[model samples]
Target chain A: MSKLCFVTTGATAPFTALIEAILSRPSLDALLECHVTHAFVQYGTAKDVYETSAKAAREYLRQQGKETQLEIDGMDFDSSGLREQFKLVQDTKGLVVSHAGSGSILEALRFQVPLIVVPNTVLLDNHQEELAMAMDRQNYLIHGNISNLAPAIKASEEFRNKMSQFPPVTAGKERQTKSFARIMDETVGFTDFNNE
Target chain B: MLPACPALYTTTFLLATLATLLVAATLRLLTILPHTRSTPPPPRRRPGTLTRVLIVLGSGGHTHEMLALLRDLDPRRYTHRTWVVSSGDAFSASRAVAFETALAEKASRDTGEGKEEAGRWHVGPQYYTVVEIPRARRVHQSLLTTPVSAVHTLLRSLTLLYRSEGLPDLILTNGPGTACIVVLAVLVLKFFDLRGAQSRGKCKTVYVESFARVRGLSFSGKLVGRFVDRLVVQWEGLEGVSGGRAEYWGVLV
Candidate 1:
């Protein structure tokens, strides 16, 4: 089984750009040898378009004499099944190539997985880009555009080394919460009524 | 200044007094005879007892930030915790569950206990509950039906608070449309004695502005910003902009 997993969970919009970029890579044959499981969620994409795209990708693979190992999904899977999908990412223990959604980034970070974030510029706000850049600044993940997907993947080994030394990103430290609680105590007398 | 006509002044004064009295009487009646019958108050907790807390979870970034805020809350201090999420927002619900699970695991690990009981379903000493209520308004949804949905959600939130074994002492939220309705419902419940005598101390509402809104307040934040007991902004720059209502909390998430 290939350890590398490429996830494109574009719940609000289809990330066809990411999928096409991954499939059209010249080094598809090299990746095939790694047995990479290219799991792509074509969320919000029309069924016909997805099918046509997948079929074309498969034909391209056939022409290149490369075996296809692609798991493509439509928009059926949503937030409800996020944990289950994240389990797949963890099980793979490979590099994660994902769209720059906070939820996705957090999940990948939770597992300390080497990640390459590709921001979808088509979104109304550039918030994803911001999140990606911030995470990149933290050395948590490689933030790359779709066009740079190949280089991003190639840099995963180095990214993984950095991730290994980095402590897992938890929700926040206990001190932060304790401080907030103290403020709550003084402002709202939160602890006053609790005494019994 | 004296009115030009004494008769006109007298008539206007009389009418105003009558209207004021009528409104006051109506308000008193509403409180005294609420439509929903109040439940009996729970046994009063002695001083230093556990405080029941209700936290609202908004989807995506809000949920992420809230989880961060909750990460260090002393489980021993807050023994009872209820999480409320908007309907159809399984993402937030799942994140809440995951957070609780992580917290429980960490507690067990810290105490060097539950090692033998690992892999078994072990209910910890803490109490955590997750409840879902309808969304006040759906995105891209028609505004015409927003009032109906908002009212429906408010009613559901009211019922949830009323039915809970104990009413929450504090309600915390990061503003989204759903939090607005939930806060309103809680305020109404407090005013009407819908949650029984245990609701004596009005549940303190805390609204934390989303980290994304560094320059300005979100629409939902703007709506309930003033009404909440405490309005928190992560950025120091927002302090002046919020007219001193928003306390700078630094980066929470």
Candidate 2:
């Protein structure tokens, strides 16, 4: 029952900055402070960057005499999606730190694990920043800065208790807020028998 | 005998014909375009009726969101599925198959004891088919050659729409480049009333802007927004986009 922090940097473009930021010494200290024992990074074609970052972070921990407390690992990409990785996080009541790619955000939220989203700002016309801010404002996730992930790592501890649900259940306007299924049915003119 | 100048070649006549043709095309466009077009009353469709739906899937992000949006799909209603993917997109194709397999398993679970009822809503192999067309524009593809590939995609889309079992009753997509081409092909079919696509109210399209779009629509969203029967956005901030045609459905994905 080891606490795990799963970090994914998307599948296409490699966000080496995110890998370095998460594995930074300060971020590792924050994780250890929160009792996190294992850290897994999905580097996605940035193996060298992940390796170098992990080595530096581990050496830093060794100097502080906390090297045996936390273990760090890395992997290329997972072709079958990251379901297994997210499931481990859920079972361990751990955290998911991911690039603010919509695909990973949507997947991680469903597992009800506290998530920290770090958007890659180098890409032109990056809407990932907007999405991260909006989702963060709603308390769906924490928007982590690429320059320093230590703050987000520290926040993950207190954030777990009050996290909002994903695919939110419609409240007072439940009847009016149509699900995608109903929209599909209505677009084709199929109303349930009683609706007419 | 000197040949009399024909009326067809006369400058005034040609100009008048050109004007008339322009007016006719405009009028035709008004009759079919989503916002300006008159929506005919939809025909009655009962539950359990055999219906076909076309789903357009793109690379990673769009494909994932589209699947989440369809999580509650009732196999009993949408009996036949046509999954459209861009060429070389093996991930999307495999995900579609997995979705169908999951649906079949769920159907069986719901009717575990009642074998007869299981067959009714079961998503068997024959119930869904995946069709792949050429990419509209590949990554790093020269801009000069983009039109060539785009036209190729469009032509294949036309064949896909026409060759399906009659026309699909519904088209579901989430703003992918290839999805835009398919919607364009559907418009072409409806324009010509090919196979009663328009007259029969077939190919009714619903385009969902990606869940990731919190602030605005994507490039494909902007292009397909005006033409789709319904344009849905997940976030409330984007409710009034595309001249208020975008419907805010409260984070559908």
Candidate 3:
């Protein structure tokens, strides 16, 4: 099986700009040739709009005599199913392009997948952009806008290398979990109780 | 001349009253003086026991943060865990269930036993219960109706708590509007018990302010600040602003 690339826009918002940029002819040709054998795009709360865009992209690809290899969903996958998809990403040594929501970024990072984060500009407060930039600064991922989608994909080679040095997000979770347990033990007076 | 017996009785009574007054004043001063000293005695230690922990999860970011904290808690230490969320938040509920499943899988993996033993771990309800109550204030809900919704939520929370096998030993929250109702429910129960009613186990509240609140406390954090057993802020600067009640615990998320 060919390598996979997963793209998601979270559950609540639409990132059509990211979707459009990724499905643009040049990006598709580059991805098909150099990167992924299959692509899964989860459009999230903007199903109808994304479906229309996906149809147009497919038609354009067919007219250009290029084989279509994209699977698009209007919304997110089921919880269990999404977990399996992440597992696929890990298994295939694939990449992820995601909106800069903390949950999405962290989940992708947990699998140690090379990531490209495009902040949805429509979001309030520029929070997503800030998060994306910070992660980029740490060399954990490539941060870009929809305008520079192809270059960000090109940067994935560097991102994959940087990922080896970057610690798995699960390590942080495990450490925090241990500290939290200790706090609970101390707070609840369980230390002495456990000894007995 | 007055009768000698009457005069003697009157004098004895006067002297006794004066002596009693002086002794009472001295005792009061003795008790009050110790507190006036600069250094206070260390707080008494509470007896620790396996606790029932109730974790309140808000949608999205709040739920994610709480999950990270929960992952760190030793499951054996908290014999019973209950997750509370607002009604209509199916995402949080699903995530809670998924986390429990993953935990069970991890436990089985650690045992390194046969399939039969792993099946044993999977048997029975996992260590947690998810309880959903009406939101205190729905998005775009009328301000006038908010109190009604809040009261409804409090009543539901109280019932949920009462129906549980035992009162929660502790309640953990991370700045959600729904948490206010749960905290209120606990306080209301405590209030009734205080008035010579049936005793419910003392349920302590620990509110961890979200890490995003760098400059100030969120509205829910501010509301529960005075009431929670511990107000934990992740940022050091917040301690000064929280009237010294908020303890800086470093970043939890």
Candidate 4:
């Protein structure tokens, strides 16, 4: 069983920064054997980030004589192999870090990984920042800015031991009815009602 | 005047035929031309108390149509808010779109065997779960923690449905997201009215052919529209989409 730090999300600019920060950490890569999902690696090639980062990470691994394998298009959401991947994470107390896609986030939580929720944010305005802020404020998730991600990853372990202490879940739809309401009122020629 | 020569007569005949064809083609183009035209400006909207509309335009040309339609609506009578979604983090006019995620799911992370599914589900680079439903049924999808918070979300929909705010005099839609929400809102309001929910008045709903191919009384149109006071459209002589029941609003772009 291997302690996997999985990075399967696409080559969004923020995710690129996340991948770079994690790869450059002094002993962080050694603590958790890194395996990027094909997405980061493949598009990185087209984007050229993949070649540079993978080359750097691979070189470090070779110098250290560790044989942790890197995989592409391998992890599946619903296969015996997926379970094996889950087991690899769980057996070694896996740490799953990813973009803040709800389906992916829910699936990881359901799988019971020692989760490190790295919510994604655009380089510009903090859109995902608000979602991450909402979840983090309630203490339901572990997220931080990419600049502070390394420290945040360090902090996620303490959260691992305390996951059970939290309530079964802290959740509800806090009236995105407002978001959709704004959308509906505008589309249906009902703006006065919403604006009021 | 002398009797007209055959050549002159032939020229007159050709001119008449050309004029008639030109009119017919112009009418046809006017009928199907999507909601973006600067010519023959949209009618001056009536001064009736109007419904405020918030339109969320997706990551392409549809946003432009929404803008054009807004031009026809009397801004004072009917408040218009539009959010135009574009690629590469375009500034979301918080006024228009409340928020935006990537238009659709990206390709990758095919859990176990998701390669084919990813490619099939998305529109090229987009990644949201887009679907088609009737114009009258009402469902509210939002950016909240509980994807479907059964109690709170349901209660919110109920409030929006039976209340003065939810019960719009009319809801017309362009994007699938907006149209679907309008449809869901209609259904919820109707259910509540039957289940002892109060309503000040019945609301109207309109659907365009761009989003659906209605015909033979859409189960959705009929289902949601039954309680709805009216169902409207832009074109005349719809044989299927609305099942001949939708009121033709005369080619509203």
Candidate 5:
């Protein structure tokens, strides 16, 4: 079982769940491998959930007398180097979970990794809830509500199996491009190719 | 009636001829004044400079070009905030991810919706308009929630009705399709005070002409270029398009 879970959070993520997951790492020490990243702190954001999660994880490691090997660091997310982080996730042979940002999700998809998304909806009331609910509409994501995250991550048969699939077929749409060309030709109609 | 005054007749004829000629000359001068001066005044320097600008992205390659220019702004002096007025196409999710920017995508019937409504699926003004009704909008909300409702919603719904209301300031339009609208929006609010309209818009419009010509002479650029306060040609070559009429501040995003 490839059981490494790496999370790099933005200013907004499900921090309480992260704290809970990280704090309870010892309990699952024998069952799974965990790598929790606490990156949300550096960016002038201090939510109780993220702080608690980071603190709990640190305390748990200290109690167990084990060195904390989880990669927790500050990052400038708006920089170009952010792409390398996704590339790292791609190379890792394990379950992948990312906070819902179109970039991350798209990257995960490009790498063909099974991705579980925890939307930034905890910060606001938005259509993300609907998107999370509509997972079956397209095989893009498995919503990270967190309650089912452990089970889903441990055995996300749907996403795990479909990792090799390409994005939904867009074959017929090419004809539309041709039709669009026809309309353009009809309107502007005359072309002097010898404008050169 | 009293005596045949030959001197008086000649004097009267001369005076009448002079008066007629003077009147004709004055009337002719009046007609030419409006046309000769109708080229609009030369663009003037705006008060206060922009440090951060939020540009809304539209269909085709406009969104792509916008995302590309966003890569060039200095983070200290300017923060380029972008929101794509997008739809649920296969491209949206990928492009949104690629740009690493938040998208305000909604179920617009087509590109026309953004021209007048808050946020809709309409990709560009070339293809869409605002035709939303309450019942239809409710159905839209029920079916799709991705299309966001921001200040843009009210601005769009009320644009033509109260076009002089609160609208964005200094909209830096770079797309070929949305030119007429940017001009209309800028000119409409130019008469009245609105958000970002008077100051940033002292006709302060930023455009990259090479990026703009998706097909040919961007219709929207040509149209809106007439009124936008500052028309920025990203390339030195395109400075001619403004034809010495618009003020060129080198390459502006």
Candidate 6:
């Protein structure tokens, strides 16, 4: 019954800061408090960065004498998508820490795991911050700061029960809201004669 | 005096002809481009009408969002799908194929009686096609040569739209340069009324802004906003974008 914490830094641009923040001492203490055992990181083209941070994290864990309690590992990228990783999080009722990429956010939310979205502020004309803020405001996710992710890690315990559903059951109930499928049919002028 | 009089008459005639042509072209443009504020009521169409839909998918986020948006697409309704992908975007192309395969599986699962057709249900060459056109503007492509690639994309799009089977009944796209060009090509077909494109109400476009665009429309969204029949934004804050044409569908995809 080992609880897992999965961290994905996205595939294209590596969010090295996220890796460092997640493995920092404060973040580790928060994970231990939450009883998380296995810490998995999807580094994605940041092998050197991951190695450096992971080594320091291991050293800190050794000094704290909690080396056996929490384990850490890393992988490059998953071409077939992160379904397996997300599924593991769901089974364990674990947490997912990800860069503020909409694709990852959308996919991870479907699994109903508590997610901490950290927006990489290094990129030029970055829209990730705006998206993370909006989603956070909606209570769909917790927006984590790259400088210190411990607060968000601690917040996940309470936020898990109250997390809003993704692809909401009824996004807008006031005015007849429609699904994308229905919209496509409407755009094409196709009325469902068969009621399908 | 006779030579001067003839020259003046020739100049007057030429000016009048140019004015008439300009007026006609403007009227044609007005007819072709989608109305900014309002869309015409969707004409009634019966089920299983052999409808075709053209989907524009780009690399990475665009492709992912497009697939998510179309998660519940009915293959029976949109019988033929022409997936337009950028030339080097193998991921998008393969994802399109994978999506169709998933559709086939779902189709079989929904109707147990059609279990035998599961192997070929709404898949293969008959049900869908993946078309690759050159990128409208490759990443870091020099501004000087962008027009050249843009023209190439427009021509390729035109050829794809003018198939023998007929034009797509609907063109569904998200934010992508290739999608913008495809929408432009559809407008061109309608402007000339090529094979009754506008008269028959073919090539209707629906552009969905990316889910990541929370504050404002993306660059492609701004470009194709006015021309597309429907500009759908997932976030509420972006509802009135593109001169109040953006529709808020509440987090579609």
Error (Å) of candidate 4 at residue B64 is 28
Ranking by TM-score: 2, 6, 3, 1, 5, 4
Candidate 2 chain A vs. true chain A: TM-score? 0.94
What fnat does each of the candidate structures reach?
0.08, 0.80, 0.15, 0.02, 0.00, 0.80
Positional deviation of residue B121's Cα in model 2 after best superposition, in angstroms: 1.7
Query: What lDDT, from 0 to 1, does candidate 1 have?
Result: 0.67
Candidate 4 fraction of reference contacts recovered: 0.02
lDDT of each: 0.67, 0.88, 0.69, 0.41, 0.41, 0.88
Per-prediction TM-score to the true structure, in the order listed: 0.65, 0.93, 0.71, 0.37, 0.39, 0.93
| Model 2 chain A: worst 10 consecutive residues (lDDT sum) | A187-196
Error of 4 at B82 (Å): 27
lDDT of 5 at A94: 42
Q: Which of the predicted structures, 4 or 6, would earn the higher lDDT when compared with the native?
A: 6
Chain B, model 2, TM-score against the native? 0.91
Per-residue CA lDDT of candidate 6, range A1-196, in tens? 7999999999888889999999999999999899899999999999999999999999999999999989999999988999999999999989999998889999999999999999998988678999999899989999999998898999998999999988777734675567898889888877653333
Candidate 1, residues B3-88: lDDT per residue as tens digits?
99999999999999999999986785455332221223334443335677899988776787787676666565566789999888
DockQ of each: 0.14, 0.75, 0.15, 0.02, 0.02, 0.75
Quality of candidate 5 docking, DockQ: 0.02
Model 4 chain B: worst 10 consecutive residues (lDDT sum): B125-134
Error of 6 at B17 (Å): 4.3
Instruction: Name model 3 segments beyond 4 Å from true.
Output: A14-17, A25-34, A62-65, A68-76, A146-148, A163-178, A192-196, B1-50, B97-123, B126-128, B162-164, B187-201, B209-219, B222-227, B231-253
What's model 5's overall lDDT? Answer: 0.41
Model 2 chain B: worst 10 consecutive residues (lDDT sum)? B111-120
lDDT of 1 by residue, A66-101 (tens): 645744444444645355555666677666677776
Interface RMSD of each: 6.8, 1.3, 5.2, 16.3, 16.2, 1.2
RMSD of each: 8.1, 2.8, 10.0, 20.6, 19.9, 2.8
